[model samples]
Target: MSEWFYQESQTESFLEREFVFANFLEAFAFMTKVAILSEKNDHHPDWRNVWNKVYIKLSTHEANNTVTDKDRNLAEEIDRIL
Candidate 1:
C-alpha cells in the first residue's frame, strides 16, 4: 500500500497518510466532507489537522485495531475526494 504508510504496534496496525491542501480552509473543508462520508459508512478515521495538512489513520477497532476492507474502502474514497 504505497499510497498509505502502514504502521504497527503491540496493540494495533493501521494505515496512515497525510493529505495536504492549498490552505487551512481547504483542509478543513475536506475534513467536513470526510466527516459526512465517515458518518455514512460508520467508519471514522483517526485524524489530526494542522494548518493545511490532515493526517489520517484507519484501523478497525472492533477487529482488534487492524486494517480491513472498510479501511481500504474509506481510504480509496478519501483519495477520490482529493
Candidate 2:
C-alpha cells in the first residue's frame, strides 16, 4: 500500500494523501477538524471524502501549483491528528 502522503500520480507539483477510517462518521469528523484548522491557517487543502476515506491534495496555487512549506507543515499537523 502507498503511504499517507505521496507525489500525486505522475506529478510532483502536488503532495497527496489518503486517510481511511472505520466509517463515514469518523471520516467526516476528521474532515471537520481539518476544515477548522485549514480555516485558521488560511491554507486549505484540496480534499474530498467518500465513505470512510479522505483524500487530500496540497499545493500552493500562488506558486503555480508547487508544493510549499505550508503544505509540508499542514501535512505534519494532519499526521499529528492521526
Candidate 3:
C-alpha cells in the first residue's frame, strides 16, 4: 500500500486524487460510498463531482495540514470503491 494519495506539498493543506467513471450513476455511487465511510469514521472528504468524474481531497480539519494516516486510509477506501 502507498503511504499517500500523492506527495505532501507545503502550498496545500490536503492531498487530492481524481477519478473518472463511465456515467453519472457510477460517480454518484462512489460519492455515496465515500459519504457513508466518512460518517462511519467521522472523517469527511472535500469532494466535487460533475457528470462522470469526481475529485476528492482529504485532510484533517483539526490539524489544518497536509495528508495524514486518516487521509491516506480514506483515500485507499475510496480507491477500492472506484
Candidate 4:
C-alpha cells in the first residue's frame, strides 16, 4: 500500500517496494514467503536482495510488463505477508 511506489517509463511500468529486515536471515525468510505467494497467484515479481534489504517490482508480463490490476492485487497480498 502506502509504502509501495508506482514507477513508470517509456517501456515499462511497475509497483516498487523495499523491505528491510533485522538481518539477512529475516530478509531471506521474507523472500521465501513472497515466492510462495507468487507461485500461488501465478504472478512472479522482479526482485533483488542484498544483506538485510530486499527490493521488489511487480508487473504483468503478459500485459507488456505494465502495471495492472494483477500487480496491485499482488502488492496488496505482499503487504499482508509482512
For each candidate, what TM-score against the reference? 0.94, 0.87, 0.82, 0.97
lDDT of 2: 0.84
Instruction: Give candidate 3 misplaced runs (Cα > 4 Å).
Output: 1-11
> lDDT tens digits, residues 1-82, model 4?
9999999999999999999999999999999999999999999999999999999999999999999998999999999989
State the lDDT at 51 in candidate 4: 100
Q: What tens digits encode model 3's per-residue C-alpha lDDT throughout 2-82?
A: 533564667567778778899999999889989999998899988899999898888887786667889878777876765
Error of 4 at 51 (Å): 0.2
Task: State how far residue 24 of model 2 sits from its true place (Å).
Answer: 0.1
lDDT of 1: 0.94
Off by over 4 Å in 1: none
lDDT of 4: 0.96
| Maximum-TM-score candidate | 4
lDDT per residue for candidate 2 within 1-82, as digits (tens), equals 1354556534448888889999999999999999988987789999999999999999888877788888888888888777
Q: Whose lDDT is higher: candidate 1's or candidate 3's?
A: 1
Q: Each candidate: what lDDT? A: 0.94, 0.84, 0.80, 0.96
**What is candidate 3's local distance difference test score?**
0.80
Return the number of clashes found in candidate 4. Answer: 0
| Top-lDDT candidate index | 4
User: In angstroms, how far off is 59's CA in candidate 2?
Assistant: 0.3
The parts of candidate 4 lying over 4 Å away from their true place are none
